[model samples]
Structures are given as C-alpha cells and as structure tokens.
Target: MSQTSHFTKVNRRDLLSAGAALIGAAATGLAFEPKASAEKPSTGATHTEPSATAPNYAPPIVQIQGGQLRGYRDGKTTVFLGIPYATAERFELPKPVPPWQGIKSAQSWGPVCPIPPMAHVGIDEFVFPHRYWVEDEHCQILNIWTQSTSASAKKPVMVWLHGGGFTNGSAMEAYAYDGKNLSEFGDVVVVSLNHRLNILGTLDLSAYGPEYAQSRYTGTADILAALQWVQANIAQFGGDPGSVTLFGQSGGGSKAARMLHTPSAKGLFHKVVTQSGGGEVLADQDPAALLKIQQQIAAQTLANLNLTGSDISKLKTIPYLDLITAGQAALRSVAQANNQRAGWNVIADDNYILRQFCDWSSDIPQMSGSVFSEMSSNYVKSIDKNSWTPQQVNEHLTAEFGDKKDAIAAAFKTSFPRKQVQDVLFFARPNTRALAAKAQAGHASVYNYLFVYEYPVNGGTTSFHTAEIAFVFHNLTEPQVRVATGDASEGYALQDKVSRAWINFAYTGNPSQPGLDWKPFSDADPQTMVFDTVSECRNIHAKELIALLPPPPAPRF
Candidate 1:
C-alpha cells in the first residue's frame, strides 16, 4: 500500500525525453516504417484499399511487443483490431502471448468470449444489432484506436471496460463502444478488450486446493494483465502510459470500481469513471460462503455430466457450450436449494481486491454517475404514455413504494416540477444519492453526474440504461444509435459536449469543459451535473425522500 511500491511517476520531462529517444531510434532503422499505400488488389477483399479517389490510402502499421500489426485507417485515426494481449488456460492466470516472427493482420474484431444469449431480455433486445459475434476461448484480444502511430505523440490513454456484469458482454457488444470517433475527436488513444467471463472466468476452486487460490479473481486478473500490457506497450501507439484512465458502464463500471481497490491494478490507471454501475457494495464474497456455493454447483455439474471428483480436470476440456449449460444448471440447483439467485463471477476473495468499496485515504480520483431512469419504465408494457393518468402513476407508485409513495412522489415533484408523473416514478435519485454519498466519504476528489439525455425510441425512454453510451463515445451516427435516437442532430450536439467532458477528464482529473463548470461533489451539498439539453449542475438530495427510503441493500457477494 506504500506509494513507493506504485508505478514510478513519469513526469512531462521524462515523457518528452522518452519521445525524443523514440524519434531518434526511428530516424535510424530501429523502428519499422509506415506501410506504403497500394491500389486495390484484384482479389476484391473487404479490407482492400480504395483506389479511385483515395488512391494513397494505406492502413497504419505499428510494432508491438509481440509482432508488427497492420491496422486499418479511419480518417485521422488508426485502428488496430483483434490484437492479443494475453492468453490463459481455463480458470488460470493470464500469461503474455509468445512473440511472433512476422506481421499480424489486425484488421477486424477477434472472437468474443462465449456468453449465454440474452437478446430476449428487453434491454439487450433493443441493442441486439451490436451483439452478434463469433465466440471462442481465444478471446483475450484488445482493440485500439489512436490518432497517431508515432511513439512520440504521447497522447493520454483511455481504456474502456464493457458493461456485461461478470457473466456476459464483450468489448464490441455495442456499436457505441467503437473508439474511432472518440480517439480522433479527443486526440487520445482509446483501447477496449475481451476477457474470460462466467464459469470460465469466475469459477472459484480455491477451497479445493492451494493451486486455485486465485481462481475467484481470474476475470479481474485478466483485466490487470491487460492494463499491465498497456503500461508497457501503449507508448508505441502514441499513448502516455502514465496518464491512463479506466472507464466503464454498467458491469464494466463495477469492474472499474473493483480496480480502484485492487492491489494489482494500483498505479496502472490514474483516473476512474463508473457510469450506472458504480455502487456494488456486494462485490466481495465471504470465502466460506463462496466455497460452499461453488461446491454445490460443482457437485450438480459433475452429476449432470456423469463425472466424479476424479474427472475434475476434464471439466476444462469440455465444450464451452456444455460447460455453460452445466454451470447454469448448477446455479439453478443451488439457487433453488438456498432460495436465492446464484452466480459464478468475481468474488472479493480479500486477496487481490480488498474488502472495501472506497478507500478514504486513496489518491485515485473518481467520477461516478447513473442515468436518470434505468430499468424503471422499461418493465411496463402497452402503457399509453400520452393518455396515462396521474392516478395511474400514483397507483403504480403505491405498488412500488408502499406506504411512503405519496411522500416520495411529493418530494420528487417539488425538485422537478416540469417532469411527468412517469418521469418522477422512474427517477434514479435513490441509487444516485447512495453512490454520491460513498464517493463523498472518500478522501479523493469525486465528481458525479446524472445523464438526462432522453432517447427518442420506444415512446421516449428518458435516460434509460445504456442510453448515455452513444453520447459518451460521440457515436450518435452509428447504426444502432440512429435506431435509438432519430434526428440525431440534437444528439450530436449533446455528444460533442459530453464526449469533450470525458476527454477533458482523461487528459486531466477534472471533467470540466469550456461551458460546463462541473464542481466536485461534497457531502454537504452533494452536487451533480444534470446532463440534459441545457446541462446544468444541481443538488439532487431530496433529504426527506432519501430518509424515508430503506437503507441501500447490503453487500450480497
């Protein structure tokens, strides 16, 4: 925990010197040359260069630790797709991939980690266009988009973690995750990656033997390994390794929060951003309880597969699909017996990740926020938004809030007088206040924001889960984004403002941009930036409402 043990701080002077040395090396024959542009080949491949107008177009190639990679070009950005950072055996720590002899074509996305199909879920179903991909265990790959391929560029780095809890989701699960626009617009290096998940990543075997002592945290360790790789090699892609920021949404946000307390992830990143997935007090699990759950699932899985304890090693060799099916069956069995839902995912374990949500004395700056309405109105079907009555809203509120419905409704209406009853019903005040309270208690500088941008889809789902993604990445023109937000001109304007704030945060710890004066959250006022059409900072604590609500759920892991 000592500061001396953290990564040596690389000052501006050191970065300049390193950049100068890289340029000098490149002047000689030490560094590889940029690939020469060529005309379209007769093969007519998808990655072929355009020959008529942009005849001089050629993908930029960079030399990494493993080998040379030829990445495609997108206007000002150079994108290296499907670059492997690490490899691992089933349920084991990741190891750096062996260096190759020749250039590797990094032109397309790599296979994603196998995840159960969840398109039937309404939220995912809406974003289904971005979900399909070839899934495989060779999923430990990263995608990078940089404005400069020169090592001397020294741009700030931003690594994105995808948001499918520990169980599902991939780096490119959503079109909003694409880094081309963000990297180009911010003039910063953007990176995202895929890692093991579900049973393959989080199955805890430490109770069985010392060899598996770290099993509970392999998924997180894979992220650590990716960060380590970034620290060592990102400079080659014009990134300043010393100024890296870890940012994510939903599950990815929780992972980012986990890294804040993880010893291995210490110093690998300088700043953190958690959107919607910030408060997971239950991230860590009691070892005995976790072991019991794992054992129960293991027994059921083995019985289903007609295998005994002696065939344990064979579990690793089973088809990935079969493993998922067995894991699901075991989880259902355990959940039924224990009268609770069960999952095989990241456990605090108290080894890699300490048993704390936020460390008051830690120096890492953090930014956490949730959408204005997440999973609130999405559950309602066939409801007439235009003809809905206030009585209907009150009835639904009574059903959800019980005896305190009127008190909560009155408080919410007082704060946002213009908002509809449905809007008041789905307001994310409770969870957002809880997250802000945790962040304010920490010693580090903490900023909170509420994404209030309403999507013009599904009869206007206002700031629903994942709605802020397109704006954050400045990807309003993406296909799925257009489907979600019609007439994207307004969305584009908001995207510019929001993405600039994010870029500013990555560059410096402060997220304040030109027109936006984003103040840090304080325990007294608890200010939050309301990211709406006119974006303004506001205090969000309806003290009476918050006090009436039950205490936030306890850590469940």
Candidate 2:
C-alpha cells in the first residue's frame, strides 16, 4: 500500500460546499461526471479543488488492478463511475474483470441488474429523488469518489450497499446515494456498487447443478466480488483498502450486517453501520430444512417454466421478466403451503453465516438505527393527526389499537412528553433491543439512533422513512431537501452534527463528537440518540408500546 505524502485538508465549510454541489446535480437528473482526461496524476502533491461556482473539468486518470482508467473532478473530490468490478452469468459466481488493452471510459454508468420495470416516481421522490439507468444481467459494476487519484494518497474507503431488500434497487437509484460530498466531508474514498438482485441472484439452482452449489445468495456474492475489487484496486484510487467501513440503509443495512456473518468478507471491511435495517434477518432454524425449502421453490420455478432437471441449461436464455415472474410465483406457492410469507431467504447451510449478523464476538465497531416514522399515520387518511381534537385522539386510538389504546397512549405520553398524542401513530417501534443485547453478549459495542426530525412538507411529516439520509449526507442544500426539512438554519446545523458523527464513526469506532456525546446501546441500559433539533440520549418507550400492540408486519421490498 502507498503512504500519504501530501494532504489536501477539507474543513467543515469545504465539506458543506462539496455536499451542496452534489444534490443540485442530482436534483436536475444530470450525470455529474465530465469528459475523461488522458493526463497522468502526480504521485504526491498538494492538490487544490476548483471553485464551486464554476464547472472545472480537471478529469483525473489512474491505474488499477484491471488496467488504466479515467475519471472526472467535481470541486474538491474526484469521481469515477461505472467501473466494471466483475462479471457473472445468470446464477453463477462473479468473475473478476480481465486486464484490458487500453483505458476504459468510466464517465458514464453501466447497466444495472435487471429488475421488474419500476413504476413512475411518486410523492416519495419529493423526500428522496432518484436516478435511473438501463438494466442488464452482467451488472457487476462500482462507482468511486475520492480526494485524489494519486496512489500515495491513502484515504479511508466507505463502501455503501443499496437497499430494495434483496429484490430491487441499484447503487445509483437515489440522489442521496451520491458520494462526492461525503468523500470530501470525511476526506475518504466513497464507493457504491451495482449488484444482482431478486430471483436472478437468489434462485436455488444448486440442487440441479454444482455451479449453483452455494445456498441461494448470488446477489450478495456480487457484492462480495465488489469488495474484493476494492481490496485489489482502491489504493490506486487514493483509498486505504484495509480501512473500510461498510454502511447502508434499509436492505442495504441488512446487506452490510450480512458481511459480519460471512467468513469471506472478514478482512474486506473493518467497521460497519446499519440505518433502519438490522436484525430483521437471522438464521435460527435448522440450516438443512431451510435449504430443503429453497430447493423446493427452485424445482417449482423450473416446473413453471416447463423445464426438467436435464433442461437446466434453458434457464440462461429465458426472457428475464418471464424468469422472475415465474420464480416469484413459485416462491409464493411454496411459502404459502408452508404457512410462511413469500420472499427469497438464504439458508444458513453456509457455515460462515450461521446466525444473525453480529451475534458473535468481534472488535468491529457498529452502529444501527431507524427513523421515528417508518410508517406515517397519514397513510390512514381518515384522521388528521396534526389537528386531532381530544375526543378524536381517544376515538382514533381506540379504533387503531382496540381496548389497549389507553395503555398505548399512556406509554406514548411517558416516552415522548413533548410530542403530540398523534405522534405515537408513527414513532419507531421497539425492535432493536434484542439485537443490541445479542451483540453486547459477544462483547461488541453497538450505537443506536432514532431520527425524529420533522420535514417541512405536509405541515411537518415529522419523520418519515428515509428522512435522515439527506441530513447524514450533509445534503440540505438540495431543493428537495428544503422541501423535506425546510430552509431552517437548524437543518444545516443538524446535518453538520449528523454527517460528522458518521464520518467520525468511519475514522474511529465511535461516533461521539464535540457537540453530541453518543453512547453505545445494550439491553441493560438501552441508551439511544434521539436525533432532532434538540438531540439527546434517552431510554425509549417503543418497548412499552410494542407490548400494547400486535406483532409488526414482515418487511416489504
């Protein structure tokens, strides 16, 4: 690994400016990359960024494991997009990219793994805008943002895994997924990748052939391949391959935690953070039985396609949509028969992943958290939570929670004394205590957070799903961010605190900073960072509330 000789310092103001450029580019739906440059980089030198008010086209080029490639510049951070990390056939292990004859143009995005056609953008985009690309099966690609392309500038690498369960979503799906700002903010190399998803990556074809021998998780395999690529080439992109932090939200969080139980991913990452998605998946049942059910689903998928074991080769050429639709139908049939919900689940047949992520001992510092409002009472449409009369609160809570409404209301009042009675309808559920305890038992320190910041939209959505992403990315300058959090100076200050906490966590194991002193969470002292204008550590009421209601529904993709 190369050593750092010259450093380009990025202070908080510079960080904020870098992040501001990111969202505007994302909001306009334009690719943030510029034309590739053929110029080679100086080994070690003080590199200054161009002014943000103008577009400075100082494209950067670097040599990596595959070969020489080129990237572009956006103010302080340099960027490279659509770099092919690996390639794989339908339901096969990822194969590393071969050495190329010449420089590959990484200015544009590569094809995304094929998923069901997405519906038109809804109101959700108002909170989290998106970027779309064409789809393909061989979609093993990665993107990079860094302070320099010099081999000697070894910055920390933060790899992001995207959400959409194991079924949908790509690295470039969300505007907030942009990395240039975060890279500058933390002075680290930011990476995000595109991997296989849904049935194409999880079909249990191993029973019919040896190539598919691993228990149904080729989607995660694609991610593992991306990590391997980072280990081999990130240093050339000014990243410290050994100092990697795997972080993601929703399904992406589960993906990051999944790496904890994966033996192969052991040295690829040094730390992890999961937002709003952790401990939802665990392998506590018999591994053999899990594999058995998976194989049954695979067989049914074959039957739906009118193919037999001898005709397994036909799967490669089948239309992508026809294949996925049939696979989903087969999964539903099998899951329903077993009195289980339909979804593709990997068996713990692989010894490396025998239980929930982080259930075993390790020094790896981890953070897990969720928003206060994963589901809004606005979904009910019958009650105006913002203007509920005292009688309405009583009548509505009774209808929503039945006879336990009184108990739930009291618990809500005790937990959130300042919040309105209607807020209980959307606050976070008590679900992470078990995971915290499990990790603590193994001697691992885990930090928890609850984002209750209210967005300005709809008289204050308070805290909807994915509300914290922009704040954590320090992307409040985006017009959409203004729509979500309003033009409050406090929003800027909150972004600084939140984004800094994440950056500090990436550098050290702990997220504590000068302003906010965060603490690790465990069952004995369930301390949580309740993020808002007045953020503080407190014991929560979600546990008391959970006892008053029925079990929460299974996750949806």
Candidate 3:
C-alpha cells in the first residue's frame, strides 16, 4: 500500500495550505486542540486556584517520592487531582520536585500550562464540550483516578497527553477527559497531566545557546518526565508501571506516537493508541529542514519582542500574551515567507526526543485510527444531510463528485450496505487507513480501527472527529445524551464495547473481546475493527471508495 501524502515537500504556499488542513483536522477533533495563552499567571505571589473540586479534607493519603498527599474519593474510584510531577524554569527541561516536609493537597485540579490560542473550529459545545482552567507557566502537574492506592493492586495505567498540537490544551481541557468513569468502568488507573506547549515549549533557540537546546522539545519532555514519574511512583498508587499505556487524541495522540522514536521513552510506556492525529507526526521529513523552520519562527518571535537572540533570557519574564502573540505572528510570517507548513513540533535534533517516524518494533503493541468521517461532519455541520431529499443528496453528491458521482455512490453503497446514500458524502480520510498501514508496516503487531459509530446527534452525523471519545471513555449519557449521541440505550451498549476494548488492549496488549475478535493488521491479512453499534472486524476496503471520490477539501487548520 502506498503511504498517504500529507506534509510532502511542497512549495511554501502548499506548506501553509497543508497547515490549514491539518489544523482544521485537529480542530474538528484531532487538531481541534489549540487556543491562545491567557495573561501570564500572577508571578509575584504563588499562584492559587479559585475554589473548585478540592482534595478531601481528610483520608486517602498516598505517599510517593515528592511527599505524602491526600486525594478525595468518588464512587468506587480513589481520585487524586493536581499532583505535581515535576517543575521547570521557562523554556527549560523539567526538574524533579524536592520532597516537601508536610502532606501536600492533591484535591483541586492544578493550573493548566499556558498556550497561545489557535483559530477556533466553530465546534458546538453540544458535540465536544470543553473545560478551561486557570493558566500558569508553572503548570507541571497531573491528576489520577484509580480503584485503589495500594502498591500491590497493580492495575494498568493509562496516561493521557492532551490535544492542541504543541500550541494549546491542558489535561483538563475537555469534559470527556475526566478519567473517573473510565477508570472505574475499566478497573484501570487513568492519569492525565498538564505540560509546556507552543512557543514556550517548541521555540528553537539552540541556534543561540546551549541552555535552550532542548526548549523546542520540552513540551514532549514534560510528558516524558511524567511517564518517568509514573514508572517510578505509580506502583504506590496501585498501577503497574510496567503496563503503562500512553494514549491520546489529536495533538496528544500525535505527540504520543512521536514518543515511539525517542530513545528515552522506551520501557516507560508499553502500549500506544493514537486516534485521528498520528499520521501528521509519522511523515518522513528532513529534521534539518524542520530545524530551519523553527529557527525562523523563534527569531521572528524575538524580533517581535524588540529583542534579539542575545536577550533571550528576558523571555522568561515576558507576559503570556506578549510571548504568544509575538510567536503567533512569527508563525504566520514564517508560514507566508517560507510558504512552508511549519509546526511547533519538536525538531528531532537531540537524543532526548527524536523527530519521529516508525520508532517501534514488534515489542510495543499499538493501536492507531481516525474517526469514520473525521472532517466530513465538520464540513457539513450546517446542512441537515440525513433529511435531505434524494434529489438534494444527488445534487450535493454531483456537485462534489462531478461526473464520477454515480461511480462513487455505487462504490460507497457496495462498500457500506448499511449506510445511507448521503454517507458517501462523508467518508473517512485515507489518512486514517494510511496511519494503520504505517503502524503495521513499522511494528510487529498493530491493532487497527475505523470509528464508524454514527453519533445519534444532528441526524446521525455522529461519526465526526472526537465522536468516539465519549464511547472510549464510556461517557455518553443523560440530559446532554442526545447532544453527543442520541439513543442513550444504544450509546450505552456501544460504550461498554468500545471502552472495554480499550481497557483490554491496555491490560493485555490485545483488544479482542468475547464477540469482537480483533486481529492484528498485517500486509497479508489487513483487517480493521469497525467500531459502531455493531462493532466487528473487516478487511481494509475504504480505499476503493476514497479513490473514486473527489479529494477532500483542505480543512481549516
């Protein structure tokens, strides 16, 4: 199978164009991940959060390397929030926290790492609800939910990296990110954390000095540090560090997949699952070329601040908006100048975190996929496709597929008998299947999936980006039920199957369950587990339909 072309070496204009599509993809769900940084956290005094969910006043104390800490209890799960894993100075790699003399509070969610906000994708809260937190530059923290705190319980640990590219997003950015339900439902430990991102995290200043050599990679370094902390201390929290699974969506997923190639990341995580975002990270690009792009952005940011690289130290005290705004302008200028799609992605320049490709062997079990209609739902959000008359559907299909509309419709119907004719207009990106193919080709055993579960919302446009997250987390329910997925009963049933498969995959490196016999994807036997109302495995065949349809329009990055 030929690899899907995403960020191929194109003219500078084409590069920026690609960024628009990718950023749109991320916005829809995968890349729908960024926002600008808020004003820098008050620096004179220690930052404090407004009253939120604080740790319980008593009980649930668990001691680790940092100090003794207390978390609250919720239902069957023992929940811990805002636990610091490491700390760092601006634009530097993280450092170990010194042990405190007294028990620290792990009750309230910690401050989120500040990020320069990106363009919004006009997502309705009804589809993907978001949660914002107080922002701080010193946000190196984590949250945990588990059934037990005993070291001997040894449950599988699922550490989530947030989306928002390396630009914006926090551990607590979304409502579905709450790990309590997934933790309790799967009988596994769930951990999510905040880290450095965007300009602060990925700006390359190594061109000027060694102190900032790893600055561009620090966003990832924060994650790597968190994993190291988990391996070292999770045993005390009833998690088997040896069984850690690093999974994420969009930017988070892309970053998690990128970790596979980092020399320091081995053994820290045993399994990997990336949904709808890893394809951008695995593109084979010249690291040196990326380095030049990053340097240009950083230099531009510096000039925007009216300071040269020699005064880079002043960046530590710059306001979040000043820094972010400068950086954002730098990105746009560089994007236009180079006409090259530039990213805040780490320029694989060091041994700490390598620029990623197929950095896996058969030893690491993996799963990677995209939503069935990753961008289709986002594109057609304003139109009510399901209710469209046959003529209307044909008109739309004709407008999109031109003379090839009939062939495409026939192929789509033949390929998806259960699907409505309009579904041919909302096809999954070839990149999703391409991502799975890359994983299979790069590793020994890789489980693949295509999330086809039509969300019962907006007349079954449920297969949009980020739709499956509610299911994977077992979170689609109640009052807001119809907003996310209609037919609560069917949604509930599918959640059980989807969430359990994730839990099983992390628990034993196999996603197969009693009825859904998931087989590893391979060249000789390519198969993908289609997750929907009736989850089942099928051969890879979306290619025919994708081939016949017009190329998908570039999504707004």
Candidate 4:
C-alpha cells in the first residue's frame, strides 16, 4: 500500500477552462454562461471562469476516411463531444451511421437516447445534467472530454454509461458525468454516451419473429459499436484507444457486467469499474418466456388499437412515445400475471451475453460493491407512514421470504440487531452481502468499498447507492443540486479521495498507484475499502453471511 503522496494536485483553473470548451457558436447546443456567485466550497480553492475568447485555442481536425469529428485545444489539451458512432433505423439496432461530408461539430452534448419521461416520477432514481427530447432514431452518439486535440496527448480514456435500470435514463441527464474536473485532475480523456434502452433496446422480441430477433440486446450492441468508434477515432481527441476503461453505476454497471462476458465486447475495453450496481446475475428462467411476453403484447396492441393488417404498419410507424405507452401497458399485464419486479432486468443470453460472464473471469480488474443499506431508505419511504408498524413489517417479511422466512429473519437478526428485521433482511444485508461475494469469486483483480457518508440532505445517514455519483464527478457543491450528506469539510475530503481513487484506477489497473496502498481481492483474504469521515481499506468478516445462502447452482445446459 502506497501513501497518498502519489496523488497529483489538480489546478482549478485548468478544470474550468476545460468545461468552457464544451459550448459553441450554435444557439441550440451548449452555451457557456458564467455563474455570478462563484463562492468556492470551503476547501479554500476558489472557482475561476475560463477566458471568453481563447486566442490560442488551436484545435485540430481528426481525419477519418469515412467520418468527421470536431476537436479543440484547452490549456495544452484537446476535447471532443457528440461524435456519431453508429446510426439506427428506428432506435432498435445500431448500424453504421453514414459519414458526414464536412467536419461535424463535436462541441456540444449529443441528443439524448430514447427513454421514458422522468419529469413526473415520484421515486427520485435517475439524475444527470442535460435532458433532451428524442428527435431522431440516430441516437447512437458518443462524447469525448479530452486533454489535447492532437494525437500526441495520448492520455488514458474513460467511457461512462449512465444507469436508469434500462427503463428510464439519458446520459445527458446528470451534471456529474462532466469531464472537466476528472480530465483535468487525471490528465485523461472522458467520454459519456447515449444509446437505445427499454423496449427500444431490449424487448426479447427476436424469439418472436425476424423483426423482434434484432431488438434484443440492442443497447449492448450500441455500446459495442461505440467502442469500435473509440478504437478507430479516440486518438484524434487525444485519447489512448488501447487504454479505454468502461465504467458505470446502478443500471449502467449492470450493463457493464453483461459486457464483460459478451463475445462482441471482447478486446473492446481493457478495464471496468462497477460502482454499487452489480453482481445480481439473472437467476435461471425460461428463455422462451420473453418471446411469449412479446407476442402477447403484440396481440394486445393490435386488439386495443382496433386495427387490422393495414393499421399494423401504422402502429409500427407511430412515434416512439406512443409505442412506449403501449409497451408499458403490455408489460403491466405480464407483470400482473407473473409477479415481476418493476424494472425489467438484463437477461442472460447464450448468443449476445454468455453465461460465462457470471462465472467470474480473472483476466480483468473489477471494482464492485454497494452503498451501506441502499434499499432501506427507499423501503422506509415507500410504506404508508400512518400504517407503519411491527406487524406490517412481519407481514412484509412473510410476503417476501415465503418458505424461507425463518432463514431470512435469522440472518437479518444477526446482521442488524438494532434495526427492524424487515428493513435489514429485505434490503441492505442481502444486497451488500451478494455484491461482495460475487466480486470476490471472480478471477479478475477485485476491489470493494462501502460508501457510508450519510448526507444531511437525506437526514444524516450514511451515503445511499446513487449519492456517491455526483461527488465522484466532483460536483458536490453545485447550487442546483444538494449532496445527500451534510456540507462538511470531511465530506468534501472523502469525495476528493474517492474520486481520485477512481481516476487513479482509470490511469492504472490498480486503485492505489503512487499514493495509497490499496489491495485487490484474493481468495485467501477479501478486503474492502470503507469510505466515511476517515477512509480505511481493510477486510471484515463475510463468511457467515455467505454461508447463509447455498452456492448459486451451476448454469443449466
């Protein structure tokens, strides 16, 4: 374990300048506006705005025989954004997006991928900075936040995938995905992308007919195509294509896990970071089940719309939003009949995503873990406050555990004696235990952490699952958003520490490069880094919890 001395200090001036380079002359795209009160966070580092006009902003053209992408200079670095990697006919499957004649401005964020509207949601699940109306099917766009416009910069590159449970999310939605702070701090290029999701991406319709077969894993396919684009053109944006790292949280982590085992994704990315959102490999279920669901939905759509053969094509031609509404209704019917969870999950596919991914390959480095008691906060808020009681807890436990009630209750009792049996059993204990076991079992170098910084915004409990995201992006003090934890100097330092560790991991395969002595997962010793007022990387007892559940049965032939 190295000490913290190896971590480099990031100049605030460089980060602000990199952020300013994202806007352009185009009115419809990103427009840089300086904030009035730039009172820096109590860290003593003040905010400095970029120069309105950078006379020395010498940008370069990335010459692709078939494609054109924009790039520009910033304080000895170059940045590119919104470069099209592939095109889709109807946002279902990705194909080669036709090349442009002149240089396409990769200056602003791209159009958002198609997803359910988030404006009316009560459960505050997904969060990002920019949200755009879905305007076209060619939503397979990728952005580059780089350090240099020239190939000579050759910095490590990181590609981020936003998570929304594969149902409702856009890469453009959260402000934390910004590359300025990270790119400047680590001297790396960062990319965030948009791709097909939900019914638009995964409907398992392919088992239904020829049209449907192309629909399954479309989101994963979109990601592969984006990686292909990175391999060919990231150098133009001053990035090292060979050193690309794929990272995401929540739903995005779920996707990255699947990609780890995917044949199509082989050799596309060298490193992976799974933050608080992985290890729930799908339980064995009938493959034919999805096809059946799709067929039932198709039938329902035709009947409800009162349409014959001629109207069927019109149904397909209807806007993406209308199709989404019809799909939601169809899914509701299936869920009612089968008792499905609210969000459709990443299914194991023999063709696209192999079951081998679940087996834990040792070839790569994996960072996997969860927030402390992630599901509890949501569980507490979901139940009717007036009707909440111990009896209600018992009833809920019985409903969830069924025949396994004794086992579940006993496990919860031992793990969280101070808390209610229902909260601990149903939410926190199972998840954290599950994640740690899965990551440890894999052959790859594994790093685990528990995010426990409780935010005052969430009534002063340790951090929640998604709370670490914005802070990891170095956006904790932004006025538009509040950190779930209180505004304290310790909290800020923890943010910097964790975020730096992430950047360090992107730069090198290990989280502790020059500064910290971070240890990877081993069969003999399972260590986890605990993030709180003071961070410590050490091991805790997990064997008892793991023994509570039988080993996951081998995958069926």
- TM-score of every model versus the real structure: 0.84, 0.85, 0.86, 0.74
Model 2: per-residue Cα lDDT over 339-458, one tens digit each: 766566544555646564543337677888888877553522433477778888887777778978878888888877767877877765746853674565566578888887776555
Q: Lowest summed-lDDT stretch of 10 residues in model 1?
A: 1-10
Q: Of the candidates shown, which would achieve the greatest lDDT relative to the real structure?
A: 3
Quote the positional error of residue 146 for candidate 1 in Å.
Answer: 0.9
The sequence of per-residue lDDT tens digits that candidate 1 reaches over residues 468-548 is 888888887877767766555677888888899899999988999878888888667678887877787778655655676
Candidate 4 or 1, higher TM-score: 1
Q: Candidate 4 deviates by what RMSD?
A: 11.9
**Residue-by-residue lDDT tens digits, candidate 4, 315-425:** 546666667777777677766666653234556656666655534344667776677656455434544322458787777767765777767667655643434455443
The order by descending lDDT is 3, 2, 1, 4
Q: How displaced is residue 102 in candidate 3, in Å?
A: 1.1
Cα TM-score of candidate 2: 0.85
Name the runs in model 4 displaced over 4 angstroms. 1-60, 71-77, 119-135, 282-285, 294-315, 342-344, 358-361, 378-427, 430-442, 458-461, 481-486, 513-515, 522-524, 542-557
Span of ten consecutive residues with least summed lDDT in model 2: 1-10
Residue 273 accuracy (lDDT) in model 1: 91
RMSD of each: 11.8, 10.5, 13.6, 11.9
lDDT of 2 at 298: 89
